[model samples]
Target chain A: MQISQQQRQLIQLFRHPDEVEFSNIDWEALILTGRQNGFLARLYYQLERHQRLEDLPQYAFKHLHSAKVFADAQRQQAIFEANEINNSLSAIEISPVFLKGTAYTLLDHPVAYGRIFNDIDVLVPKPLIEKTEKQMLLYTWFPEPIDEYDQHYYRQWVHEIPPLKHASRRTIADVHHNILPPISGRAPNIDLFTQYKIKTEYQCYVLSPAALTLHSLVHLFFEEDFSKGFRDLSDLHILFSTHYQDEKYWQQLRFLAYETGFTLELFLACHYCEAILQTAIPFTFKHELVAFSPSPMQLKCLNWIFLRVLQPSHPNYESTSYRLARLLAMLRGHIKKMPIRILLYHTGHKLIKAFERGILGRYSDTSSNLQPQPPDKNN
Target chain B: MQLHQLKFDDYIHKMTNDGLCLDLGVGVFRFKSHITSVQQNVYEMYADYNITEDKPADFHACVKLAKGPRHYINPQVHFESDVVTPFLPLPKSQAFPLLEWGMNWCLSAYDFNHFILHAGVIANQQNEAFVFPAPPGSGKSTLTAFLAYSGWRLLSDELAIVTPDSLTISPFVRPVCLKNNSIKLVKDWFPQVKFTDTATDTTKGDVAHFKPPANSVKQINTPAQIKAIIFPRYMPNVPVTVFKLDIIEASEAIASNSFNHNVLGEEGFKTLVKLVENVPCVELQYSDVNEVATFLQNEEW
Candidate 1:
């Protein structure tokens, strides 16, 4: 509940806007140490206003450094677009997903639009995946060794094949055969997905609204990847909030999941959207259509919290709540999957380690920076 | 307003109530009076003296700190000697925001063991943090401003701090740097967003850094694990496409854009690699923002 000193200072600055001064001393302490974007922005504005920045010869020199970054973005974008087009053409059935510049910008607003990309993404037909692989080689897009296992796994068991990379662009894109995994232990019929495709200026493939939401939820949870969840969450928030007005949308969503053999994804999607996005699904639809048990939002919130506790800094209030839900869900997962004996053993081990790292005040040589040596690694 | 003594030539001063600390230059000095300390140095700067004057007329009236040579300055002016850095002119905006946003990848890059990532971040009202990490042409700043202005909470528009845990993303709340056409892109998108004057042709090509929204300005230090690390490259006449990157490969890409990977050593590398491993990485190629938003709505992060 308490605000950090930095946050408190922000409040003071906002209240007494004019008196706030950005001096060189402030620059070294606050700006150099700062790790966030907001502080950088505020500083930029303050310097420009005072006119003190422009007068300094050194400041003008620094401007060149930032300018180069801008130029690189422009060049990188050109390279990315070329690769995406090439990748799409080579794939048997190329369908674009939530590529922010290509799709997110088209759907979302301008604020989420910053940053340059170095790659492209597209979905290809499952059956022609092997052939698509052949075409990719022609375009110089190859697979990394790490994806060797993923490719095999996806080809045999999952909805999307292992991601492919372009040798030239150094960018990789995933090729999806279906929106979600075939939970029934069989490849979910491809026709079911292709049948729901909506064509745009980009291409002729997209998951249905119901399917997209279910797939998004499954991706968020079952996939357990949060890299782009912020953007994805924003998207889901908008999609569900905007589409929920249609009374029949929920029924259709349930029907798609059931028919596509990803009923679990549907259940989870509803669980997360409501828990994090505060998305509302109709009660009648929940009762009559989605008979499959939906995970409780309260429990999900707890699961999220446990995961969030690992953050170096406490998450914002909403993030904290969601983390709690996610934490609870994680526990539920462990309980459902692991035997009681194994769970107890794992819990005991974790507790012992936590005690050592926390209460004992012992800094073990193993984890401590006892030895200073050069690190051997590269990009 | 209390001054304390310290060991070694290096003097120390800090705010008792806050996280502000300063390292003044080395010197052997005695307190001249209760409220003021006098020393003869490179010109004579007084420690604590309250004088009512703007740019003092007489330079010798101030207590002189004798280090090497006599440097002349107004006696009434209270120089910030607490911090080791030399006196600098006042910044245009608030101190915290200006320094937080403006001092990245500049002359003196601090060793934080994490890259000063150039990206924009935003969270929804729900506080789900999404990061768009890209170079200038990637349309990152433009997209960030658009998203923040639209509905999502603006976490940052420049630096995306990736901790050793790699899962945590700290907020920077820096201004969104809009270049050339993007200045119009954002202004046209959200007429309400405030912007600093567009400085012409300094480096980032007809650049203007958009002021952080009032709400976003307050939460600059709040950190979140990157929900998404998007690499956006804009291309005219190209259809929108998003590609998912494998974690290992994504790690390489992320590393390339890192500002402090070299300084962070193994822990930094491991953290970043693990981050890309756990999070989904994608390349977005697009020309329009609306479709991009629609596509974003369709995918699961």
Candidate 2:
């Protein structure tokens, strides 16, 4: 994948935050591009860790200060919401297992330092899914409105229920019964995943170290869109690099991957992390994972597509190949997610909606008629 | 060099490719617009501002016409930053106003180092500033226009960016946004003042922008010290009166009108408190701009 010079510098700083020699770099372009790709806060966190604030140019320092302030507020809000969720589910006696960003945040993992997310994702036992939704509703979380076709699709094929948003705060929660959809024919056994859950300091449960990495792999590799590819892949790098220091961790991860029908995902994750981020993997583990690698032709094609799609989705760095590769990857993702009949129906419905909306028309003119008003005096 | 020095063709070419960078007091804005109307608006309104040739800009803004089916039918214009579209498209006729709104959004949204308030600010020759914090329909813009022409320097008509460490308010000398009946009122009051073409049926009713005094644009980099905070309310057919507000009440009111006070957390709160404690606070009620202007002119700290 082709990356701009500015992106390369950002990645270099991410990997090595202690080196603060930025005498020749263009801080203006770097800051604007970082903000564009939603990496400014993360970059600020890294630089702050090394106490390199004084080294920044005046303009960069001011903007970075602002980004840091926003990131701190977001972190505090996420923590407050986590506590609220815990209180809401206390009656059911079923501790919701936090997934992805929320889990990392609750566990105080380094990967969560500057990360910002829109929704909190949680997994529950399949039998308790209904009870969980009821509990959420009792706590003022209402299900968002969905059209009939999409509602049926989620109920029949998706792993999660329709997303629920808090009535007052508008925070979103994705309630799931399993990590992957059953229609994919590769859903991990719920009981097996539950066996590996560990309690956090906050008294909520999170996936064990090996389960966490494997689930992240499955989530990223099986997705139809790459809008979040760069951020998710960075999470993979941070988690793997942080955990691989313990020999026991690596062995347990490999064992869990094979037992859970995710060896292929594990292989691709390690391959890309090393190939793209240049994350250091032990020679022995790299050799061992090669046994589960795909065929040579499949490996070549996957590498080409993942490399392009995984780069930052900023238009300044994107190209014709990037768009084509993303489209092809989307098709492959749909194939992996559903059977032929379901895929045809879903794609057909979406195509009709697109036609009716006239392609580029995401919003109706009637909706745009709402005028901007000044903020209320009492607000 | 100033933007006015560029030939129209050269300006369009630069804007389409590299961008035409303008130093806008607090930060430099690099703008690229394919629409001719937007270009003309910038040329007229920003003529007094400095132009940066190859320097880096704090923000990169563009106003691109919508493509595909909507482009040919009811053509729309979109305001874009590098990666995000902060707003929906407006009709092509509103491109210039869209540019103004977009530039204001970029400053108020991204410039987090300052404690930004939805207020009008102006200064005396001594650099003593009065901050007017009000919501819409408060006649803040009309009051500001009146003062700017009556021996007061127009600091800004909308955004007031106050530095946190030092409570000095930075000037953002852009055009004053006049809404509805205020549009015609301002035009009648200042017959010599230049305004962009009025945009009707906008979300803010009928909208137009009053150009800032060229002297204000020339001295944009000047920062002003706060001497007073005034909350203005306009009520028709009422005698003009000014009431002093307690320090606590004034601080709370100013903080509520700030754009990013919550994001700045404790520092934001402390800055506002310190400002209110040091400056006199007052609330003024009036129906006539002339009366409000005279009251401000006769007041002493």
Error of 2 at B192 (Å): 1.5
- DockQ for all models, in order? 0.02, 0.41
Could you give candidate 1's per-residue lDDT for residues B1-301 as a string of tens digits?
A: 2122222122212111121221111101111111122111111211221122122111111111222111123112122222212222222222222222223422113324344555677776556677677766778877877777776677667666666656776665545666788889888877876665654643345656565565664455456656677788888877788888888768777877776654455665677777777777888898887877777666677
Runs of candidate 2 exceeding 4 Å displacement: A1-3, A17-21, A365-379, B246-248
Location of the lowest summed lDDT over 10 successive residues in candidate 1 chain B: B25-34
Any idea what lDDT model 1 has? 0.48
On lDDT, the candidate that comes out on top is 2
For model 1, state the Cα shift of residue B117 in Å: 16
Candidates' lDDT values, in order?
Answer: 0.48, 0.81
Native contacts retained, all candidates in order = 0.00, 0.45
Per-residue accuracy of model 2 over A251-275 as CA lDDT, tens digit each: 8788888888889999999988887
